[model samples]
Target: MSTLPLFPAVIIDFLGSATAIALSFLALRYSWSLIRLQPNNFIWGFLFYFCIAMAAFSLSRGVGHIIKILLIFGNRNDIWHLLSPFSGGINTMLMISAAAVTIYYHKGLQAYKAIRSEAEKLSEANTRLSNSAEQLQMLNTHLEEMVEKRTKNLSESEKKFRNFFENSKDIIYFCDNDGDITSINTSGRNLLGLDPGTTKVNFYDLFCHDSDLLKYLDELHHNGFVSDLEMECKGKDGPTRHILLTANAIYNEKGQMIGCEGIGKDMTRLKTITEQLINHEKMASVGQMAAGVAHEINTPLGIILGYTQLLMDDFDENSEDYSNLKVVERQTRACRRIVADLLKFSRQAESFKTSLDINLIIQEVLAVTEHTLNIHGVTVLRKFDQNLPMVFGDSEKLHQVFINLFNNAQYAMVEGGKIIIITSASKEEVVITVMDSGSGIPDAIKNKIFDPFFTTKDVGKGTGLGLSVSYGIIQEHGGTISVKSPVEHPETREPMQGSAFYIRLPATGVANHENEENLYNGGNTGIR
Candidate 1:
């Protein structure tokens, strides 16, 4: 094989040079167009086409050299001779330079694209941030406006509350748990007779009498509120005024107690009017009773006077008939005793006496009525304490108490029931329990049983004043009467059962002695 290759090699080198130049120009044109396009699309499409064009050009040149060597020259000499070393070197240099330039241009373009894309992204991000900032500013403005509006409403509410609190007519005061006055409104200052600058006055010092102030304050501290509490306060003139106080407690948001506020109203005028009404009612009832009693006593007195006059005028002084006249005189004396009881009831008298045995008075009253109970078939059960001490009371009045109780018990039992009278003594008091197994008192009448002119009996059968007089008598003796009705069966717990009346009396001897000492010492000076 003749190595005649210089001419062909030159020609091949020229063709490869032409092809590389064409490829370089095409790549340059494509890159220029890509640069004019949008950054994202240009960068992506340029990278894809650059890789494909490099591979296609390399493959085409390699295959074309292989085909010439195999079919036309048939040996490695033809390849070396037809494709000159300088040609290949030049072609490799051109391809390498072109590829490097393409790569360099691609890298430079990519860097430029990255810079431009970053700038665009930054521009877009700045635009979004600006929009977000504006929206946030608007939201913050709206929130601030809402907060200001709420603050204004709260201020208005506080002003209204202050107005109401300051303008209230009631005497309102705020005090600490220790009963120290913390704040006093205008009405409260006037009520307490305190000037605005006064801070030395203790509320406890205003109590008219020494009382359970500490106990009352402790109750306020524990209960947090007090309603309808009645107390007496000494005014500036040293006269006491009655007051009704209603109080409420103040607490903080954390549920911690701060202080108590109280409103007090003067009740002195109402108390005076109530006392006057009570006295008027008593006077009216007494007048009516006095008229009836006067008539009752007048008839008995007329009969006694008529019989005494007949005896005095007709009977001889020394005769047996005169002894019979003495009997008439004794009967008249008994009639006078009855009239005396009626007068005692009609007139409110300080008939209290000393040195009386209450149990003995009860026995005497029972002796007078023993025949009556026996005739009525009512069994009397006596559980009297033999050691009952003597009481300082009017013997006749004490007798009347027992007579009234016994007669009521007898009247209650129309069918003949057992009457149990129990008398027990204590260190300070005596208890008398009168239990009757009779028709129990009705519920409707039980509360009014001791009230004046209250009775369930027929009009003629009772004067309706027995229980009332008994109550008055007991009250004067410093005793109490209470009734408990076990209106239910003990086992079944059913209703409408029997009742028991309990009378409690302070034992007369010791208490009366103490009372007399107190009276002598001016301790009882306040009694009206």
Candidate 2:
């Protein structure tokens, strides 16, 4: 045991204390860096305080060791004794502080772990809340879009219904319980001949007859609806219209009848067409029957005429028997003539058709009938358009038609009158009007004038076949014959105090001048 071992021990002690102090200072510096990065962190703050305590302990112990070595080398034992206790006490206190701080650091670490877990849970909750908020916004947007689309669809449906209501062709109307009109469409207004601005009108007043209105209301009241109920409706500016009406009773929330709504289909034109078709069918049947009867009666009529003539020859003149025989002969001849007219009316003879001027045919008819007309105190007037078109028809048949019209005019005016013959051209047809300033035909018999065996004159004066034969001839030539009486003035539709017969024939589209010369010379003309 020498002083050499003591020097080695002191040197070891000083080096060990300095290494501890350096390591503690480096640890404190790193802990300070951790604190700077997370200043409020409990773990880092606790660790930094523990590092400071360790550093202070290491510095105090290392300084005390170095002072002892210096003191031993300088042989200053008394001063070493004085400084050694204070340095040792300070190192002890720092070691205790470092140890206490290390124990408390573990408790702080447990608290820090709990705090970090709570923070993570809070972060997860915040993330979930954000997602929920975004989903809510998306749902709101989708709901808004659905609402907007529904609104648009509703608007479109309303517009379509409104369009149908306004533009529908059928007469649509609504009326109140008291037969007062409430609302009506454009077609309804037009059908009733109402003004554009008219709103209120009595439904009962629209009916052409009161009986029809009463019947319609009675049926409607008995049943809640009416379908295809036919009725005539009066107009403000025209004739009554035929309609097929369908209606449903309108009701309030309490189911009490408030009014009625209906649609009316116009059937006026259809009714006219039906009547014409029926008339055509009837004429066809009558013509067939007439032809058969005329054929069957012709031979008997001829034999009766031959026998009557033979009887007349046997009787002497100025005798009662002779007079009676003459009467029989004349009546037989008249019957034969009627039979001949029936044959013509039934279209039994084949027609000879050619393109000819209607004016030429009329002139020829006048040539034959002018003398007769003048004798009857009837004057003839002509109104022929110069640029007349050609018509393809039988000349003989047309001559018969004009002759018949002239004779009727003469008979109609017993006192005397004027007869006018007018010829004009249209776009596709030729129009001829035979007008007479005589007594106009009675309205009751006007429609019957063209029926076979129907006549207004006394039985012995006429055979009642003239107009019917003319009608048949005109029909065979694909023309129309219509009568108006009293004849209307050309400009004003007022009556001209006479009767007018209008004939429309299809044009041949050929110039009338081509056949004008041939017509006078009877070139292929059948007017014997």
Candidate 3:
């Protein structure tokens, strides 16, 4: 054949090969889609085999034509006859095998139809028997109606119970065996701050602490119920919820414990009030004793200081008597300072709460301590929010709190270091952090820092009342003071860590503006 004719044959060969590949892919999709319908059926096997044979035959013929074209056009005569085949080729053999499978499948299909027809006849007979049974069942219509009436009554009772359940002020909840909230009332949902749209809520996530919840669950399982058990739960707002939880296991008719039902009475506000009252009484008792002791020592301290000064006047500056007199004077002076602190602690000074800028108080404390801090080579940085709202408290008392903190930070770093004073406000509270880049308070001593008479300073250096007094002042102001050590340095971000004192004062929002205005209008309690 001419090369021109061979090109046409070559084109046809490629087209046929492409067509075969496309057909094979279509066949694969059809077979898979039908896999669930008649899995491993004989008819399915027949169709699969037929598609495979057709794909192979078409591919082989197309390949042979291409080879023939190449051999004729490229002047390569070494392998010409191998690809040529007769009418009864390998494809024909494959078709014959597929035809045989198809015949076998036809037989199987006939048997299946026969079996299905027999099953239909059997089903028809069973239907007649079922009809007779139904007629007998019609005789008990009065019994079914009576059962329905009883069910309606029970449903009404359930409805009444549910109405009370949903309307109660106390939280009520139902949980599955896995401690998952299956259903909860609006009060329970609101208190727990649960997502109203969520269907399944994990029960333990509502609590302040996880380990406490686990212990309760274990106890409930052992006793089959828990009654008036006090537990702390996280609230929707900032404060923790103190709940008196009462719960019991719910069992099915077969005595299988499936879930639990519970009620939670919120006692957070009452508990806080009780705690504050107790703290006040304790402070009162301590203060009375402090006053008595302070009065008893102050007279003697004053006498000793006066006598030491007179003795020093009588001796020369180089004499041993003058040096000894100086020791007496120094010790007497120290004693007087301690006495003064005791008196201050004893008198719960009349602090009239008024709206005052906390930042201004902090700035005043900084102004007093700025020279001392600079002398000790300690740098002071301030980051106060400009729009910080005024807090309702005594400016003098808050001023004292910051003064104590500043003095402590100054002493903490003997060598040159940085101290950062940051004041920021959240939605509910104003936070002030005094951070010092000095020797960090170790974990062991951290907890005792605010305890009275607990000092890390040398014997003659510190009486350790500074932190304790600061703590008391903050607590009295309805605020919280906490210290965390080994915090990352704000500027350097180094491992040589520092100490941070965090004071959080509750913020009374825009409404407090009107309150402050009212206070100014009502009386002049020295806004200065």
Per-residue lDDT tens digits for candidate 2, residues 263-304, read: 999998898778767766877788898899999999998898
Q: Which ten residues in a row have the lowest lDDT in candidate 3?
A: 519-528
Q: Can you write out model 1's per-residue Cα lDDT over 1-528, one digit (the tens) per residue? A: 677756677567557755764675566567657756755565545654564555445544554554544545455666557666655665476467547647677677878778888999999999999999999999887988888999999999999977776787666777775668887778767766777888765677777656545545656778877778788887555346788888888889997777788888888789866865675477458746865876677687778767786877787888888877777887676656545544555545568577765555665777788679879987776665555655656777778777888899888888787676666787667888777667887655655676556677896566666776677677777788777665443224556345667777777543223233322232111111
Local distance difference test, each candidate:
0.68, 0.85, 0.76
Whose lDDT is greatest here? Answer: 2
Candidate 3: which stretches are off by over 4 Å? 1-223, 231-245, 256-277, 348-364, 375-377, 385-399, 411-417, 423-433, 437-451, 454-458, 471-528
Q: After the best TM-score superposition of candidate 1, give how far the Cα of residue 495 lies from its true spot, in angstroms.
A: 8.3
Which wins on TM-score, candidate 2 or candidate 3? Answer: 2
- What tens digits encode model 3's per-residue C-alpha lDDT throughout 1-528? 655544666787778776876787588568756765878565665676667766666655556656667687777755575545642376577667657766777787788678778878889988987997787677576678878999999999999989988899899989998889888898888887766887878777777777778777887788889888888988555446899999999999998889899999999878866865666576667667777988899898898899888878999999998998998888888888877666666644577888777766776677687788889898777766666777888887788788878878877888878778777788778888888888889866765686656788888788877777777778888899888888866555666578999999987663223343332232222211
Model 3, CA-based lDDT: 0.76
Q: Which ten residues in a row have the lowest lDDT in candidate 1?
A: 519-528
Instruction: Tell me the spans in candidate 2 whose CA falls farther than 4 Å from its real position.
Output: 1-170, 183-200, 208-215, 236-238, 374-377, 414-416, 439-446, 491-494, 514-528
- List TM-score per model, in order: 0.38, 0.63, 0.46
Which ranges in model 1 have alpha carbons more than 4 Å from their true place? Answer: 1-342, 347-352, 386-389, 452-454, 486-497, 508-528
- What is the clash tally of candidate 2? 0
- Best of the two (2, 3) by lDDT: 2
Task: Please identify which of the two predictions, 1 or 2, would achieve the higher TM-score against the true structure.
Answer: 2
